[model samples]
Target: MGGLIFIFVQVLVAVFLCINFMLITTFFTKEFFYTTMRYILFAVTLLSDCVILIVTNLLIICNYLKITMNLWLCAIMFILSTVYSSVTPFTLTAMTLERYVAICMPLRHGDLCSTRCSLHCILLIHGLSSIHFIVDLSIYFASTSIKFYKQSMICNVWIFILYRWQDHLRNAIKTLYFLFMCITIVFSYVRIMKAARAASGEDRKSTWKGLKTVILHAFQLLLCLIQLWCPLIESAVLQTNVKAYINLRYVNYIIFYVASRCLSPLIYGLRDEKFFCAMKSYLLCGFYKKKNVI
Candidate 1:
């Protein structure tokens, strides 16, 4: 039953991700390059999710065969999850910062959000995120041992998630990284707000728009923290008392995944009036044309 449910969810996520990728691509055509950073991030997220779905299917296959997975694979799985978990916030932060820069520092927005610079920023994010996981995996593997027993044409592998100080170090670093990123995001927005306050007349409207953009970014980040990390933290700290929170945790996670899929389009529609208008006009035009034909 668990395996069936797992596969069901995997297929659901895969299909949803593919649909989101297509929509995002359409919404962020190259002509909208400066504003397409959000779409680009969504594309990366869907790609990462594809990796997750493939690995999850492999895990299900191994379960069916009663084959114990190799330690390397287990480590890789953990890395994939963690990297996606960590990098997503940073990517979101980048999008928020870009919006802030565009609004609060209009004079420099073009220079800052150039094609070459955007490419460099994307590469830098991927490189940094990869390095973080490589260091984590290296430290983890160095301290862990994998034991395997082969019988009945199957390998039963036993893995210890904790080895030496790897778990502790990983937790510490992860927590710090997330905290730092969150703080940076908050600080950037606060400065943008201050800049907005100093603006006059038409600039005041732009500042208000910047504030709205920051709020949307913060809302998504808050949902992520509540859904993904909050439960784990409470579970660890509450120990036996965690049972009381299980219901809320389950609900939060469900909401989180649902919201993640819905957010890219919602945020784009809310922030970019032009894009939203285009989408609405296109839909209305199609409807009228179909009705005329009928």
Candidate 2:
């Protein structure tokens, strides 16, 4: 049942992403060159996440059917998840920084977030995400010790327990990395908010828009942290009911993923008056065409 719901929500996200990609690409072709680059970033991010969703959902289906989800399958899922989890925040973080400079330093934003600079930023983000993926996945697969635990009535599972100090060290480092990113996001937003608060005259509305952007990314970061990290923290530290915790956490995970994907385009489309008008016009024309054909 959980697997079914997960697949349903993820599929919806994939569809939403496809729509958003089309809209972004079309708009970019008609607008700024840098906007084209932003569209490319969004398209790649959506495609990568869609692949992760499909593969992970398939793994869940195999598990539900009482088939042995092969270790290799698990490894693939782990790599995909690592890529999704790590890459998403950084991409969003970069977007936030882009918006910040565009608003606060419009004259310099072009020079600062140039095509080369943007590509470099993306490369740095992917490089970091890849490094984390390799380290964590390597540690996961290399461990030989196993500990068994009963999960929900649908799935009982055993997991490899990593007990060595070095293993703990790696885990701590990963946790701290995420923690640092979260802190950076918050701190950046704080500065953005301060700038927003200090604005005057006609620029105030633009400042508010900037503040909204910060809020949107902040909400996303918070949601991702809560969905991804909270469960592991609770299970490991508090020795909670693992089954209940996992089920609850998985529900939130699906909710957050769907929300994040769908919200990205919807929020941007509505918030940008030009995009909103374009979307409205597009939808209305489509509806008119369908009605006439019918």
Candidate 3:
């Protein structure tokens, strides 16, 4: 029964990711949303996360179905997943910084946060985050002692990073990295709030919108940290044997993977008024077309 439920939720999450990907793609393809570099950053992050969601859900579903998920290709997908997920936080931080500059340094924002610069920023972050992926790959090859704990179904690659690798160092590094990002995120928002607070009475209304957006971005970051970076879920396989609450492992997978995927676009991406309006029109038109067909 637990297995059945896991598979069901896994399928639902996959469907959710597909729908979001389609909507996001439609949002980007429309010419109107090309107003700023932030949209491009959101698009890249949304698409990458959509890919991560699909891959992670597939792994869980395959494992639940008693299928062999371990393959050379699986390892590659795992690294890709790690890379994209790792890069997502930095992309989000970059977005926040872009917004900060736009609000607090409006005059300079035009020259600074252009689309090309944002793309380059994202690429640089991706390149840097891949250091973890590269290290994981090298250690994976070098250490014959490392092995996947296959006691249960739904093998997540994070399980390998925790159990197989020099897990202590990795976990500490991961914890610190996430911490540093969170601090940077908070500090950026703090400045935004300060700017909002210190605004001239005449500019208060405009400043408030910036404050609201920054708060929303911070909220979304908190959600990401809580949902995806929880030590309980990440280190759970290492701390406890897989046989114990093995079924709960699937629940954790659903909680972390599905929730993270759902939150990113819905919370972060949709917060853009323009993007949301475009999506609303796109979705409503599609619904009407299907209704007319029916």
Give one clash count per candidate, in the order shown.
0, 0, 0
lDDT tens digits by residue: candidate 2, 117-220:
87888788778777755765556557643432222222211233244654466457557766877777777677777777788886777877877877887787
Question: What lDDT score goes with residue 129 in model 1?
Answer: 65
Off by over 4 Å in 1: 1-19, 28-30, 34-76, 144-160, 227-252, 256-261, 277-294
C-alpha TM-score for every candidate = 0.70, 0.74, 0.81
Off by over 4 Å in 3: 144-165, 200-203, 226-244, 287-294
Worst 10 residues of 3 by lDDT: 144-153
Residue-by-residue lDDT tens digits, candidate 1, 72-159 = 5566665665566555566777777777778767798778876676677777767666755676666546765544322123221113
User: What RMSD does each model have against the real structure?
Assistant: 5.4, 5.3, 4.1
lDDT for model 3: 0.69
Cα misplacement distance, residue 22 of candidate 1 (Å)? 3.4
| Model 3 clashing-pair count | 0
Q: Which candidate is the best by lDDT?
A: 3
Could you give me the TM-score of model 3 versus the true structure? Answer: 0.81
User: How much lDDT does candidate 1 score?
Assistant: 0.61
